[model samples]
Target: MSKPKSIQVFEYSTLICGQEYNGHHFKKAHFNALVKLNEIHKGNYFTIGVNKITFKNYVGVLQVDGLVIEILPKIDQYESDSESSKIKWQAALIEMLRVTKRLKIKEKDEASVATQSKHLLDIYFEWFLAEVQKLIHQGLIKQYYKETSQVKALKGKLEFAGHIAKNVVHKERFYATHQVYDKDHLLHQVLFCALEIIASLTKGSYLYSTCKKVQLDFPEVKTIKVSAKTFEQIPHDRKTAPYETALAIARIIILNFAPNVKTGSENMLALLFDMNVLWEQYILVRLQRAQEKKGFTIIGQNSKPFWQNIAIRPDIVLSKGENENYIIDTKWKNIDQSKPSTQDLRQMYVYNEYWNSKKAMLLYPTNAISSEINEKDFVAFQETPNVKDHHQCSLGKISIFKEGRLDEEIGNTILKWFETSKNE
Candidate 1:
């Protein structure tokens, strides 16, 4: 007897439609993968709307019972019909992470070589774990607590409420209040939460040993379930500086983590991110840095009045002095090869009108067709297509893409764009 050809294992980066996933291997893994994805999304690092799409194809970065499957993205207006686009997905993801300021880059982490590996998902997970470990080595931050519990012997003070009733006969129960070492503390809980999730997700000995060591140090501490509200309860001070890095990583992990519902089932987590938000943040951070260097201010998510008592928020606004400003809205989608989208142009028109500026930009990710906008100038205007007469503002598409030097290239591009304001 031999294995059936139809029962082949799904390879890494494999693409399949929802209809084709009715087989045994996919069926067994489907529910669990969805569960893990939902769990991982709790961290707020990214979001996955698995329930939103019913019959469409998905690009896979899924794991189920040691089986990995990736769904390829469908062809789009800016995308080529070739299969190589799926291979380049890892590069796109790495590029996005490269611009993020929250995740510190380490030379030894080998992030530069992510393009060569199909296991990018695992690599990111390992990177996160390593960062957490490094922060832990700086000595885990601790907080004082006024702990009160019943003990066999005296510790702090006797609780009259409990000791009077329970110890009325033998007087054995002792209610005590004393600061004791335990895990419910936020710092220890963060480590414990990460340890638990990492223990289930990876089998690496280093991470496992680190987790065990943390458990030993905080022997009484337990995993404290965290949420957005949990962060609000945590206070920041001098002792918490080292915890900042670990706290950021911990928040991401804890937010995305989902415990297994059934006994012995695999846990779930999601790494899906909103490309729109990521792109906006990247542009905002770089633009702010550029503006600050030139003694200017960059305000993000600037809101303005619209018709019908409505309001609109432009993504990024660069200002020199109080009144003179430039508006830029970043779109994560690909640009139209011939011209910018009418809707995008109209949106910028509103931004320009509200800001009382003659120029506005609709920024998009780089496509196959490169625009003439360079890092030194960063702006090139085109006449609005439908504007037969006086156009409200000059609308243009600025490409923000990854090049050799991301930070320097992007910073220069932003600075150059703002420089045009001097002529206006």
Candidate 2:
């Protein structure tokens, strides 16, 4: 069964900025996540000693070591010096302190040290941030909440005397900086950063939650438990794992640099399948020229790998006119020709057989790891002494291309790949 939503490992955050700090309001997702963690912990309270919180729902008295989230009256001390000032103030804030066993609200504030405050919300947010900086030496909170002296109250030995009041305003402005959260919520910042890492690790190839919340917040997430057996299905040998292969397929557009407006997820997937084409010096030039003169057109899938047992997809299949076809794939990992497993050879061979037109290729990131298909890997195309080839071999004839140039250089190269290659 799925776990409960509230306690599930989630990206969380909160905001605390006021006009005084910057006449601004802001939200911090990272900050909120920390608060959520503290709330979910089961044992001793995470001491944010000496912090105070002032929220409409509570008057968090900042003690030396703990925070207490509770309600307090709006009345302020008109007389900060009279003997009854301390008692009267406590009496006014007492109703907010009464918390029993049945309440189910966001865990209200509970701090170790607080002076007192008029604005309850400010008190709470400050106390929360204070808990975040929990070293007795930090003294940011204890140093901040100095009491107001007026004497005549009781806490047994800890007699109440001062009527301390300090304003905790954000140093930064809370204007347009935090307006988005007030209007639409900006929690996505934390979620996006986290997901970006996952997407790279997964090669932009993991199952996502179809539900909006799940999809947006966790794009590279998979619910399945990864095991040794399941892990064995993917390429475990080189940098040619399924994800790298998949990513290679996804970036087919780079081959010719002509943007194809993919309509749906399915079309996008199909286009990626066509990206695996043999890279040839001539084909690269042809692709570049075609795009420069006339925008390139889409062709069918050309992911031919006579080397593997399973079907592999290329990112794009470029066409010069209605009948011509050339393939392209993206590679995010290092590409090396040596130490390749037999499976890699077999997969490329299979790709060649299935596509049948001629030419199969493997692509990879040259920046990450320097790799090249040495000239020796190339053999004379069966019947022709003049034509040469590589062992990432093909049924008809295959070419290989690794983009080691900048965008303009690669872009020009792809245009040429389209212009000169024979139409399939």
Candidate 3:
């Protein structure tokens, strides 16, 4: 029997691509997870009442301390030819990792992989640890820092106040900056904390032992958890370029590393990433890459006031010049087969009118089972008589199931828009 405390409940939704438990059969299971989660969050985060659980537009993982509950897409059993539900989720995650320049890990044979049983966190942990280990083997970067301290014996300068206060004045207080080299630097501190956390949480895994062995050399380095503010304090230079990737990975780990809770005799730690936000970031990254090759400028979330001086911020605005541009809003949800939602179209319409652009687009993730909505669905917006300057809208679908295609698909979609705008 599975421990009720360890169980996590998530509702199935088309917007996400994964499997979850739902309905009355798992009511007790859901309650158990929520009870523990609420306690961990101190009744602040997940305070909503759960009468009937149903996941909707949100496609992300929610975690309270060590217990994580992932919300993913429901399986489409009827569509046998469709890609495996897990494959779509993994592909999206892999694309996210690549786009962020976090890691270049590609999805290998999913059908017969030993890591098939591993969780998403495990995959990321393994990758981060491996990168850190490789960097360690090359030898941890060292830098010199000035050190000053009071000593029994005079090494440099003697303090007059200390000599008078001591009475004997045998021991001298020295004020001097001595250059020293060791693993007690800021970069080493972050790495050591990340490795320690991973080692503690992931015992028995290959990474646990590896981290233990690798961290042995840095005995003097004190482990310290870091936050966003911590990064601002850390010194960065061109010489530390090689440690950049490791530092970035370590920063994320430290920021998300939760406090451990005592559960029986063991301890629990949880770390989670918001997939919806990550997906948006991933899209922006791919769009930026496309911009580089195509020689176009794309502004993200720029505050542009509309009619009545109301402030508006659209996701992405692709511009050819001052006036020639199109509005793009990325929807992490799967579009319905029949048509785009009224609210989304209206939102885009507002953007188009305000920006003086004739075109707007709604981008969605395409899977094998997703219905292919055509250009006709956007005809209503184009046919509006009040609309001028060849006003139009488009529903674009990019395949998220196929590995390593996110960048290409998004680039192509934007390029096509550019072409269409030029013709107009």
For model 3, residues 248-332, the per-residue Cα lDDT tens digits are 7777666655454334333334444445556667777778777866767878887776659778877888887666877788876
Provide the TM-score for each candidate, comma-separated. Answer: 0.72, 0.25, 0.72
- In terms of lDDT, the poorest run of 10 residues in model 1 is 3-12
The candidate that achieves the highest lDDT relative to the unseen native structure: 3
lDDT of 2 by residue, 148-229 (tens): 2222332123212211221124322111111111211112222232223223222211112212233342323223322234
lDDT-wise, the better of 1 and 3 is: 3
Clashes of 1: 16
Error of 1 at 100 (Å): 2.1
Arranged by lDDT with the best first, the candidates are 3, 1, 2
Off by over 4 Å in 2: 1-295, 299-312, 321-323, 336-341, 368-406, 415-424
CA lDDT of every candidate: 0.55, 0.29, 0.58
Residue pairs clashing, model 3: 16-73, 17-73, 18-73, 66-269, 66-270
